[model samples]
Target: MTEPQGALLVGSVNYDDAEKTMRTASAVLGGRLRRIPDGEVGKRFHWIMFQPDVLGQAEGIERVGDEPRWRRDVDARPLRIADGVDAATLQLPPLGYASAAEDSYEIFRRLRDEGAIAEGIRFQVSLPSPVAVISSYFSSDDRAAIDPIYTAAMRRELDRILAAIPHDDLAIQWDVASELGIIERASGYGRTMESWWPGDPFDGLVERLAALVDAVPAGVEVGVHLCYGDAGEKHFIEPKDTATLVRFANAVITASARELTWLHLPVPIDRDDPAYFAPLTDLTETAELYLGLVHREDGVEGARRRIAAASAVVTRFGVATECGIGRAPAGTTEGILATHAEVASAW
Candidate 1:
């Protein structure tokens, strides 16, 4: 089979900071990458786990317990609207996504100017869908009340990121994990993923995410990362195949106002069979398709098997890991990057 030509870093890296992530990715992947993320480092490392700490600081929000919930060494805890406090009136502090992006962009700019990174790569910022934060942190009773409020707050953060970074050099990725949990009606990390909204939950999810896709203006590149929960380096539930993913992708493409720059779907490490990839034939969206088929455990040969399976249905695509590598073992990041380089040709 012909090798795929590009690679994508699906947000988080296990590096100490953004500078190391960017510099190292540039040195290893080089022209293979079209965009680079800030490694979602610091408190942002464990995806949306840091959000409870931020939300807990809001006037009307309080943590459910004094001690933090332990999840792979990250401090994650549920939140609730404080008694008799109007969720609507409680103003949330800055979510920190925008400020993180802004800080990282300065480092990205310096490195590019110094010839450490290439000229054409865009700085990618990955933000969680409002549902991800609300569902993960709040109770079902509180979700509807807090959904619109948190969404607006996230929009404000997006606006800040858009204003601070140059449009031509920016790409925004909306991370959609909880939506899949809802779609599958499965529990992730012991919590059931259910939508509190009335009517069909699938439609609600599609519309919610499509609005986020359209929120990015015309010049900026926008994409969606369709994920199964990546807690403890495993999916909350291993998908039977790509059927649900293809359906979701087609729905989002039809629902969105703007063309998606790319769409990424995960491929389980063991799924290198033709049946597992057959559903991709029904994927109607015309965007850069990226299969998250690279696995550090099996390296280049494993990626090649999944690539061969995917090639049976989709003629063109890019390569990435099943999800961010932030939770990966300490010494495995470089090997994973090298695996992508070995399987896909540099752009």
Candidate 2:
């Protein structure tokens, strides 16, 4: 089979800081990556897990439990509107997405100027969809009231990021994980992810995500990462096939006004058969397809097997891990990066 070209870092590398993440990824991946993310270090090491504290800081919002819920070593308490406080009138504080991106972009720019990074590669900024955040952090009863407010706050964060970073060097990615749990009606991290709003959940999900896609200005590249919950390097539910992923990608493409630069889908490590990739033949959109087939355990041999399976349906694509390597075992990231470099030809 022909080697896939290019690679995508689905955000979060396990490095100690943004500078390390950028320098290491640039050194290891080189031209294979069209864009690079700043390891999502610090408080973002666990994606979206730091959000409850940020949300809890808002006026009229309070923590639901005295003790925090622990997951993967990070703790976060669920938040809700305080007693006698009107949810509709409440304003959310900054969610930290823009501040992180703006800060990281400086590192990215400095590295590029110093010739540590390639010129054409963009700096990728990954943001969680508001639905993913609202559903995960707020109770179902409080979701409807908090959704719009949070969404507006997130948009403002996006605006700040746009203002701070040059559009030509920017690429924005919406990380969509919890939406899959809701779509499959499965639970992740001991809680069921369900939509609080009435009506068809799938339609609502696609529309909301599409709106997010359109929120990015035309000059900046935008993409979507479709994921199952990756709480402990495990999906909330392993997919039966690529059927749902294909359907979701097609729907988002049709609903959105802007064109997607890329779309990434996860591939379970066990799925190396043609059956797992057959549905990709039905995908109608032309966005670059990235298959999350690189596994640290199996390395190049394993990625090759899945690549061969995917090649039967999709003629061209990129390679990535099923989820971010932020939570991967210590000392596994360099091997994972090597696997990507080996299986996929450098861009």
Can you give the lDDT of residue 293 in candidate 1?
A: 97
**Candidate 1, residues 73-121: lDDT per residue as tens digits?**
6568889998998887989999999999999999999999999999999
lDDT of 2 by residue, 1-75 (tens): 868989999999988899988998889899899999998998898899999878888889998888878765556
Instruction: Report, for all candidates in order, the number of backbone clashes.
Output: 0, 0
Give residue 120's lDDT in candidate 2 (0 to 100): 90
Name the lDDT of candidate 1: 0.93
Clashing pairs in 2: none
Q: How many backbone collisions does model 1 have?
A: 0
The numbered model that scores best in lDDT is 1
Error of 1 at 29 (Å): 0.5
RMSD of each: 1.1, 1.3
Candidate with the greatest TM-score versus the true structure: 1
